[model samples]
Target: MACMQLLLLLCLLVSLCNCYRMFGRFSRIPPEPQSDSAVQDQWFEQKLDHFRGADTRVWKQRFYVNDSFTHSDGPVFLMIGGEGSANPAWMTHGTWITFAEKMGALCLLLEHRFYGKSHPTKDLSVDNLRYLSSRQALADLAHFQTVMTEKLGLGKRKWIVFGGSYPGCLAAWYRLKFPHLAHAAVASSAPVQAKLNFSEYLDVVQSSLARNDSDCPNKFKVASATLIQLLNFVENYEKITSDFRLCQPLEINTKMDRAFFLDTIAEYIMDVVQYNNDNREFEGVKTTNITIQVVCGIMANESWGSPYDRYVEVIRTILKATGEKCIEASYKKYVEEMRSSCWEGPAASGGRQWMYQTCTEFGYFQSSDSSSQPFSGFPLSYHVQQCTDIYGNEFNLAMITGAIQQTVENYGGLNIESSRIVFPNGLIDPWHALGINTSLGTDIVAIPMQDAAHCADMYPARPEEPFVLPAVRKLVYELLTKWLQL
Candidate 1:
């Protein structure tokens, strides 16, 4: 039951990333919440559109630079921010900062073009969101590199790009696109492959649960089976409503409401699993490290309650932790909230921006259609429906498929052609479903961190963390040193 707070932190923590969209803010949103008293804010004048030369539109992109440990002609380590505010703490902290000190490199963390304080558009309107894409973000990195080199009077210093999660994709892609600008890349938990039917997301989640406690998956499976039964029977509808303690009575007959109710439960569990233990905290909420293990133990304890009841307890407890009176089970309200154009609620925290990105480009929708997975309420169709509703009718399944095809073709997807890039994926991280988890070539290497969660390797090695993380960090440093020829 203590794990409830951690799950609450998962959805409500704006500094991180999850809101029924993807990743726990899917761990892309709020960066690790650190005190910014020592951090200085810096901004870069960037072109909104890099593709069109005629468009002179520009935006002030936020960034932080740490040259405390620098040398003339030393390498520059640029940590790319993903789908959230760029924290200056990365420039000072993180495993990369250690490498920066060892190699006498200058550290920089650049905010994504439209995220955080970097507003490339006046509003997150559909028309303005067109400027936001991975391609454009990559171009921003390219231009930023040039700006830094000239602005700081650094002559031809080797630039190593670093990113985790989505930006991890950006780092690897940046290296591939502008090899001359970026000498090497460290893409941790980088999902390079653009997947539509990302049912494997839950596969990893279930596996992670089983890893903590083997019977935990069985509990969830049994619970899901019971839930399926409950949803199927009209007589059990009241029991379902009473058991979950919904604020609004669930429209049991409506397909959308049923999905909303079941998916809401599945989502809380999925969020906890996806970002199980990356050691990130936001606002006043705590990290999900110890809670994940605790939750697994609770899940398997039959003495506590039945499997379905325990499952409901997890959701109910989490909702209670979030300070909600009851479950907001209105699918219509949820859809309306997502469809809202203003930069409040989901829009303010980059969820809306990222949703638009997913709708237009990367459809990394995590559904529970896979038979091997424990949960089964949220399917690929649910995501497709949300996308169509939030964006427009043009954002249909066929269009999304074509867009993903174009993205994969453009970036090479799983078969990305690149060199001097290290893709470090967590063994338990569900997002690694679309990441390159194997060695591609002599230069493009994949390091799988066992018992690790998303971007675990990116953080600085600590004694209490898993042994693989420290080893992975050491390897990343050695790779950077070798690649930079330091």
Candidate 2:
């Protein structure tokens, strides 16, 4: 009887321990340290600083969690915004932060380094910028996942990574890099390719132009010819002199230089390609005629001013702080390197490190790199391609091309097992989604909005508003949810 009683007690103890372990793994996060279980109205926003390096290279982060949030049943969704955008902005946006909070999930935002308040360096050179690459950004996500899990002490909690555009690329890359860390990832309008091809972009633009007027085939043909002429003019001028002269054309009233024209064209191309055409009445819509006029105006000038003056100013400020000359001779040298045929350093045996150096060197001066070779076959005549603006300074077309190409090649692949990629285009937008062609197979779905221009999400009546395509959202949500199941 004594032996039997001892055996029973041991069995009971084992079962109790197992139950405790299981409970610990699957339990909800406990209440805040300072709050009682009854406190329903309290909210918490915690600021955190972490060092990825030893020499005080710290990254600033913030977390917003509402104590009053009653729904703890879903996964924790983390949102990362695109390049040049900060975390706070997205946190307040309708699609991101608002969505997470309403869905009853823990919402987290990560601001990339060297952008916004997450400056990780006193010297933000191309070399140091390596940490800001897609790889490093994904690593940052993985690290945060570990930290969140440990801090919350919830073993069964699921994690979802969500982003669009550039951040969407990060989201997809994160899922691939740290498959075990995140349960699922949602990438919308993400360009997975590291490089930019003007040819692919031209095709999209031509298609959009044709959609505007099927009978206006000649207009697109003319546009294509003009674009090529401009590209050749710029390339030739850059090959000859460090400085050129600009002459005002009869068409445009704006006083501009070569840099201005090139930058403007690049920006215009990017905009038209991603235009949201479904709702033409949106306040942000610009007519195709205006876009064409703007392009022509820039190219007509001998040397226009620099495009993206603000970006140049930022670079100047950084350079000034380091007691370096605002315009270094090396800056021009790097620009020349971008235009050279041997730009990527003999492509056959090159690795990502070479690409990193090329990116960083170019990033310093707001100049272009030699990464655009892949899309060199792109016909520039489709858009107004100009060499020198009104001010006589030449724009680095080769470098810009290279960078786009590099971006496409590096991050362009998709995971067939997990999710499907989609490129939604607008019919009137010159820079249509068709510009990028990925090697990730035909799993990508392209949906062209008839009248939209750049950023279809902001269309007057988005599909998400009235839930016009709840099925699409359902598909995305289900895929992410399944991926996140821990």
Question: Pick by TM-score: which candidate is best?
Answer: 1
Given candidate 1, what's the lDDT at residue 199? 85
lDDT of 1: 0.78
Q: Pick the candidate with the highest lDDT.
A: 1
Residue-level lDDT of model 2, residues 1-486, one tens digit each, is 543454454343232211111111001011112322332221122112233444444455433343233255766777763343242323333343434555566766665544433445443334354455655566666766787778776566666777655566677667666667766666555545443322344444445444434423343233334433544554544422222111112122122233334433333233333332233332222232333233323323335333322223322333333233222122122222222222111110111122333242211111222232111221332111222220113224555455555554555543333344344333444333432323244433444444554434422335423243334344444444444443
Model 1 lDDT tens row, 1-486: 423443343335222223423333365444334667777888899998999999998879988888889998789888998886676667666778788888888888999977777888766777888888999999999999998899899898899999998999999999999998999999989988898888888888888988868888879899988998888877787788788776555576577677767777677777677666666543223434434676677787777679988887777666565444566566675665555455444444576778888878888888889988888887899888888888889889999999999999999998989899999998888888889888989789999888888888877566667778877887888887787773
Which parts of model 1 have CA positions greater than 4 angstroms off?
A: 1-25, 31-35, 232-248, 282-285, 290-292, 316-329
Root-mean-square deviation of Cα positions for candidate 2 versus the true structure, in angstroms: 19.7
Give the lowest summed-lDDT range of ten residues in model 2: 21-30
Error of 1 at 246 (Å): 4.4
